[model samples]
Target: MQKPGADFEDELENSEGAEELYERMSFTVDKGQEPLRIDKFLINRIEGGTRNKLQQAIEKGHVLVNGKAIKSNHKIKPGDEVLVYSETSPESTEIVPEKMELNFVYEDDDIIVINKPAGMVVHPGSGNYNGTVVNGIAWHLQQQSPELTEVALPRFGLVHRIDKNTSGLLVLAKNEKASIGLAAQFAAHTAHRRYIALVWGDFEDSEGTISGHVGRHQRFRKIMDVYPEGDHGKDAVTHYTVLEKFGYVSLVECRLETGRTHQIRVHMKHIGHPLFNDDTYGGDRIVKGTVFTKYKQFVDNCFAICPRHALHAKTLGFIHPTTKKEMFFNSELPEDIQQVIEKWRRYVSAKGIMTEG
Candidate 1:
């Protein structure tokens, strides 16, 4: 017979979606054990777990018995097995709070808004254990709420996140009630988020929308792809308006109706206008410019100036968790993006002059 939790670990290693990151623990009931509610049994067996947290895990289908999912009320019999999984992976090292600088765009009793720069990971994971936004926030919180020192490590109030290469504004809750409230807004798609992207090609229309199901790539798990037939993945929608045209490339503002991993990057690629210099989506090449050596060098220079995807989370809006008041925040483009845009403008002007000559 298979061990109680071994099956779950195997399943998680092969499962899709959020479970991919989960760390699992399993328990086997003794042969002489009496019938007991799974949740009640787990409270005694699992150290430092509350009935409420375990119940929530059960409700989310993270708990299993005898290699099958079970509810909190399920009765465990002698010879039965149990497994529990948490979304976060088990860390070998402790998460120490680093006193890093944070660009606070807005803050109050309930929440804190941060202008995250490119290259800063939102949270600690795998090889990146510190120097993340979460670490900084933990230090800030420890200072603000000295009580937090008594809690567990890696305790963060983050509700949503942006990519490591994508610079932007992000909001995090300071308390559990605030976290729950912010999460509901995100789940309902009521929060407003707008991104500015410099894409490879100009659009015929000034504004448009891209609708597709966004999910992980079939072969490459690291990247996302669009399912046009809606056969797979979750529904994602992005509304874009052309802000400026540079002939070969255009600047556009994209408004997101739904948030998914790499949604903007994948959708833009689907429309044949991958973000300029986006290394992952084939934007690092000269997608729209001439093959001339001079043009190639110019494009290469632009790539060096930006060194990452030309996308910025320019604006964010959501309702305050405590005050229930509407809040909106905006950020200026980083110097690298601004410099690359200027370079494009000059390149376009020189090209026009050559054509006239």
Candidate 2:
């Protein structure tokens, strides 16, 4: 495992930090191995492991059978590849655990899916240490077990992350093996991720792709910029489909081919439609709406409804490390996003504006 290095600290100085991956360990299930239950198979194999503990691990998706997460009773067949993995904290930083109300979408011993709300930072960075998703995860795990004596990430792990204000699904590995598996999927662009964003302008084409080189903005180093015709920065691609268009602002669903920092926001802005209310990318101002007082007030109200950027990590899908089975999860649009979208619909209706793509 490589240290995050200076680049990571620089990015976190401004964005509050969420990018993290974990170290893992793996094993293969041989034919000569135990043919009984997965827990029974792992029993006495893992250091300091007991029957109940192994059973808990299997039940929590720790012990994988042939690559998929299975229950405790799952019988390992011949030639099955069994892998066990989890994570501990990096030696560079000490993460402090804090109690928080986090929405757990799915959990097994291996990984956890969290519905991260807007305004929550995912990691402990320079200025911020406690009250982050990582902190909460540590506390949550400690509640489940009494042996979490380490102040660092003993069992806590992070595979992927979204922006601080980007609400929706995020996956975290509970151990080393799970983190490594999930990280590989994301790195290879095999993990299925879909986001819903409201942009400031209408699209000429209903569905299209945005490709560019994304990196720190030359002028505004705190934000992101795009290079259209060169190979100066990291390659980034975003595929978008127009879901609805309300004269000025439009609702879009964006699928990412590469997980770059501020990729969607930068790409959208590069194409002339910044995400609505994204303060970092010059989206707070009225960019597309009419200048009338009523229209201005309406837009302002919509902004107030969803104080953050109008983006949500709506769906996530990935191949399970142990089972290799396709696992997918979806989240509803948060109340703020949902309500603002409805407001736009009603505003367009009352104004008698029918926008044709």
Query: What is the Å distance of residue 113 in model 1 from its true position?
Result: 0.1
Alpha carbon deviation, residue 108, candidate 2 (Å): 0.5
In model 2, the number of clashes is 16
Shift in Å, residue 114, candidate 1: 0.5
Q: Judge candidate 2 against the unseen true structure and give its global Cα lDDT, from 0 to 1.
A: 0.77
List the lowest-lDDT window of 10 residues for candidate 2.
14-23
Candidate 2 matches the true fold with a TM-score of 0.76
Q: Each candidate's TM vs. the true structure?
A: 0.74, 0.76
In model 2, which regions exceed 4 Å deviation?
A: 1-92, 151-156, 355-357
Q: What are the per-residue Cα lDDT tens digits for candidate 2 across 234-298? A: 77788999988888889999998877778899899999999999998889989996589987898
